[model samples]
Target: MKTTTYNIDRINHLIQQYQLGKEEFLTLLSEGLKHPLTWEAVFKEEIQINHLKRIDKIFKKGLSYYLDPTAPVTSKESSIFFRKEKFGTNLNLASKKIVSQFEDLKISLSGLAKLSDINLERKLPVFHSHDNPVSVANTVRELLMPRFKKDPKKFLNALIDTFAEYNILVFEYVEHPSLKEKTNIDGFFLQPNVIVLRRNQDYFKREIFTLAHELGHYLLNQEEIESMDYDQMAFGKISKVEAWCNHFAFAFLAGNELLNLDKLPNLTARNDYNFNEIKTISDHTHLSFSAILTYLVKKDKVSGAIYAKMRRNQEEEIQNRKEEEKKKRELEKEMGKASTASLAKPIQSPLFVSTIQSAFFDGVINEFELCKTLNLKPNQLEKYLR
Candidate 1:
């Protein structure tokens, strides 16, 4: 039996690099090796080939990683903010996996850009912490054009397109079989230009708002993960940054017209403002119902108590709607009919796709590599090629 000698220093370094304590490392080792206790001896002296293989698998690293002192470390630091609750240990792992995927995609896109001789520069507008949210929002809206804001779906696509034009990478994560229910984050922004959105949102309006909110983080260059509910945007509870961003998103989506309360129909002076009236405003502005209500509260048009009650009612309504949709899907399955819900679409930026295609045509990458990088099947390659 052949035995390989590993530098004990490197082994210890890897353990620290992964932030794995001795006890946790032992537990991970115990899953593979029957006599985990003996691994301590191997760690101090020399390891058998079989033991080395198991260790590599446990650490999720290549065998050569332990041998080479100059090998680059792969750990990345990320700060994620959950709007609902802090992630549990399992959920944290899931969130990290998502971040890792983003990192990998960014690296691939960056390499493709370099090979294609494309210049990727940051072109997003910058705003100070104390900058007026309404002014910033108007600026962004003008830049994005008010025409795209007419339809929520069109608005979202156009927003992504605009961000891509500015060299920002925006992606929507479709809940595929492999990634179902692993993470519940609504959206997240990664520094230097990467934003991700979950594809299973109940409302396109919510997605639009989230995109705007994440854009806020992008402008401020703050990395965050958020569930981003209406309560988080409430006047008193939210941080200054969130408040500014929420206002910015409102202005961006609702436009300067909504800034004038007189434009809205007279409120009935009822505790909760009429839902129908709010719905009308939402439809006309292409803004979410919650956004309208939040603005009302901010303007002191709606009482805090009323706003809170409305929020709860809205949440209940959303829950009921989701339940109804779930049952509807189940019924469709029974009837052998396709689901009403749309399938998750690929979320690659247009620029990213074009760069990859160009690289493929230039023979910098082959068809297989292109398909793999784009997360596409063989059939999908033709669409890009043409």
Candidate 2:
């Protein structure tokens, strides 16, 4: 049986929030529904359940949100949206949605923590831009050393675990194909303590660097949204905070080899720019060989021309790899086999997991709420809740 939903007010509010006019909203729905929709029908409560579900998908809010009597919150006074004047880069719709989702999760975590009497206070000390990044990096590295791992995947997972230990909530969201738009930004830090990263399957090393860079911002108590491009680090004019963060990330990742980086001789054709040594350091640090070379250029250890040539070579290599992968996928298709592509899963923060578990055990949140908060299935809840 068909049902009517008279949620015009909520629908209109979302339309306004998305900066869409009534006609535009209806047009968008029509495209998705494969039929023309009119605002007149919406006003008269003639919209069906299927229509409401379609609208809910667009808003990313559940259907129950529209059924509730209360309207969605529009105030941004307490949000990072209002607090941070500059994001360092403009966010696309997908990036903005991911950020908003994590912000909402942080709020929920805080509320649940309070109900369970959990002390979620951040422990890392804050520093100013004038502070020596090397000194700060050394201190933070010492703190995280206990969680250190050499392998790339283990290294990233270790970092996330370390961040959780310090009361910093780390969350990763994937740029899934089903999303209306993919997020261009790599990661961002939300003040008071939440860091969000976009999952990168092809290049996990970049994700590791981004995590350390955002950690720099956290230690400096500065909030920022950034893409973390190596090319920009080598050539672009950046603010003091950004430069500090870059240096901190480098020093933290390099560990004891930071001094070696400073003491290294200038690269010249005579020694082939010490490529072998650089590669060794890169492997140890899990930073890309190109990124390490770029850092050398930034420090004046390598000339701009050499950096540019090496960068071109690296780009060419990457392109060749992509072509190879494409051919392999095509071959797989011809063989009636599935293409082998890495499917990434978001890394869960241990602190975030335990907080929801505590909430569940204390009766602050029910079983359904527990699964929802943890983003787990009913069968998966036992591993966490137990």
**TM-score of each prediction:** 0.77, 0.85
Best by lDDT: 2
Model 1 lDDT at residue 25:
68
Badly placed stretches (over 4 Å) of model 2 are 1-57, 63-78, 177-180, 338-342
RMSD of 1: 5.2
lDDT of 1 by residue, 1-386 (tens): 57876665666755654455688767766664556655555565567776677677555457876776564443444223222233212234345556556765776777777887877768866677698877887777767653546667777777788778788778888766564336656788777788888765468898878888888888887667777667656665767777777878888777745745445543445523677767876887777878788788777677777777777888899999989988988988999997666566755678778788888887889988988878899987788888
Off by over 4 Å in 1: 1-70, 74-91, 149-151, 177-181, 260-272, 335-343
lDDT of 2 by residue, 254-347 (tens): 8888777778889988889888888778887887777788789888999888888888887898889989988988988999997666556789
Indicate which candidate wins on TM-score: 2
Query: Candidate 1, which ten residues in sequence have the lowest lDDT sum?
Result: 81-90
